[model samples]
Target: MPASQYADMFCVEVWPENAPAWNLFEALQTQWRAGSGGVIGLDYGVLAEELRVREIPPADHEQLRADVRVMEAAALQEIYAETEK
Candidate 1:
């Protein structure tokens, strides 16, 4: 799948305004793509804590959590389809 599709799975909004947090998220994405476990290690709690430390607004943080759920569901579905095949 295209990289944009991966991004779409997680985030519908533009990049976060906080540069450091955005950078961290990008690094995490790199790790995510390299790993076989899909979203296994990419827990929402970790992400939310990082964003909280960066002082991201609560509303935006909640949106990120929702986005992660969307992404995790898509990843799980893809894994299931692949295994079935």
Candidate 2:
């Protein structure tokens, strides 16, 4: 299956090296669970914040953001195709 199809099925955690970032995702997931709606999207803003808090290098942050954008675009395209089917 495509990454977009399972994007919301599970959250990715780049652990050990980025444990704090993973923890941030866990916290956000907890807050999301309290709401009525299921997790259908990601909060990149919060992720960026967490990365900053974790003192991730700027170069690494840019690379991570770029990777995420690629995945998000692919996921959106997949969803659009599904809707058109």
Candidate 3:
């Protein structure tokens, strides 16, 4: 199909300016977490939905959570030290 013809025949639906992508994603993530087992990461879920338009499985769920916890602890410590200064 020619570019111009394709555009005219199938108008690409655009998200209203009011529904910013980030806001939509946050809403969906909230819903998924509330309903699902909270077994998947938000980034992976969003990327799969928007890009692949399919479900995504958690990648190394245990490892990811562990790494996040370590990072979180370090961040908290840094903040605590900074505040004392």
What TM-score, to 2 decimals, does candidate 2 have? 0.45
| lDDT for each candidate structure | 0.59, 0.59, 0.44
- Pairs in steric clash, model 2: none
Query: Lowest lDDT 10-mer window, candidate 3?
Result: 31-40
* Model 2 lDDT per residue over 24-78, tens place: 5554443221134333556776777767887878777776665555555565577
- Clash number by candidate, in order: 0, 0, 0
- How many angstroms is residue 16 displaced in model 1 relative to the true structure, after the best TM-score fit? 9.5
lDDT tens digits, residues 13-79, model 3?
Answer: 5557423343334344443222243222334454345433422235534443344444445645665
lDDT of 1 by residue, 5-67 (tens): 987898645445544444445544633432564444455556766676777687676655656
Show the lowest summed lDDT stretch of 10 residues, model 2.
30-39
Q: After superposition, how far is residue 65 of candidate 1 from its true place, in Å?
A: 1.0
Taking all chains together, each candidate's TM-score versus the true structure is: 0.47, 0.45, 0.34
Best by TM-score: 1
